[model samples]
Target: MTALAGDRLPPPLAEGDRLTVDDLALRVRVSGRRKRFALTVETDAGLTLHAPEGRPAAEAEEFVRAHRAWLVAKRGLRERTRPLNPTKRLVEGEVFRYLGRTYRLALVADPPAGGKVNLIAGRLVMDREQAGSPAGGRAALVDWYCRAGRAWAGRRLQPWAARMAVPEPDLEVRDLGRRWGTYRPGDGDSSVGRMSLGWPLFQLPMHLVDYVVAHELAHTRVLGHGADFWRLLRSALPEYEERRSELDELGRRMWMGEMS
Candidate 1:
């Protein structure tokens, strides 16, 4: 880690590096460049401001204090659910809930040759015959998950899009480091749009995955979660709040093991 210089120890954050304003909430992240300080805040609803690194602690607190009312209001509306972390996730003998159905993670060794791979009786069956080494087993499992995830997304999003009277956006699997999914509509044409869906693994519930898809799809019409956007989303999925809560809590758990 790099340390701040003594002379520039208390640099003030730049205006460009401020909070983000989304339709739903305002949030920010603080960072510092070589010799300058920066803050970022996002707020479509209220305001979120990020503090720059190496800034005086008091100044950072004061910055937040200046926007305390907005912070308090948005914080109250923020999702409070917790996500699953790396330590608690496992491969086998674990019960996972997806699409309201429970499945168990099963690890099976393949023979020395080759065959098909599948998940049977809630257990992921590996073709030991195709295994070149013991390490390949985990790789094979993740591959299976990627394949399953792509196919699953296609199947689920198709009908939903048709019912919602929205054209299905292009779907692709990605190894996004931070976001699970994102939507990008054409400059101004609602008819033209694009979306990217991430696949951390297949352990997450299908509803959560669908919720993300729906969220992104809604962005095709509403760029941000303003009142109109939320209203449009609610009209389609009355239980969106519950789904969001579920994802906020259990989404990270799915990616806990075999990755981090």
Candidate 2:
């Protein structure tokens, strides 16, 4: 006689499940290592609920409800500070930033067959065909920025890597959400280490970009921002503190979509 097959079951939900509390939706993350529940608000990851292992989901929901007021305020603050993903019209006279300089967008009809964006005479000139729509113009602009940012970082990385005594890793320019940059150390077998920098860095001054590069390079030695990390960073940049403060102020404005 033939045996009947058993039905496959779905995997059980773990700590990092999505939970809805009132009008808000939150991510539930359980940490066996933590002693208490915690709430963290980030620009990229909105609301995260960190609960100690074995806590009931119902209790977690109640905790979130209790902190609704705080969550509302934090959400508002993040919305104000986070980068504005504005809808672009891609029209002439629109201003965009490059290497901390303002460049007005201008359309040009040219012999160059394929569409391209060129920085000419302090303006971002694009082929009329490429700048025909908002989406196309945005794509062209972002593509150009990514290429420029990678090259710029490569030049800065050489000196900073030499000073930090770390081998220069690969550079990647992309939208890193809320983070400006991150250093990922390579695992021996499979992973090759690299630095991922936010494309928005091009909007800031060169000094600020250098500071970010230096900060990530320091992570190659020390993983955390401890005293040793600060000491090493200071050895390389004496005015790191001031630069950091300035970046923080400027970064908010840049993220908020203010080009001026």
Evaluate all candidate structures by whole-model CA lDDT and list the values in order: 0.59, 0.80
Alpha-carbon RMSD, each predicted model: 9.6, 10.2
Worst 10 residues of 2 by lDDT: 251-260
Reference-based TM-score, model 1: 0.56
| Alpha-carbon runs more than 4 Å astray in model 1 | 1-83, 87-117, 128-136, 186-192, 257-260
lDDT for each residue of candidate 1 in 1-260, tens digit (9 for 90 to 100): 56666655545444444433333233445556433322332322335455555455456555555666656565555424234355322345545443445666554563333334466766545554434343464456445555777788878777778656778887776656547788877666546677777656345667778788788878877888899888877877889999897776777556533432
Please write out the lDDT profile of model 2 over residues 114-134, one tens digit for every residue: 437878888888888877665
TM-score of each: 0.56, 0.65
lDDT of 1 at 189: 57
For model 1, how many clashes? 27
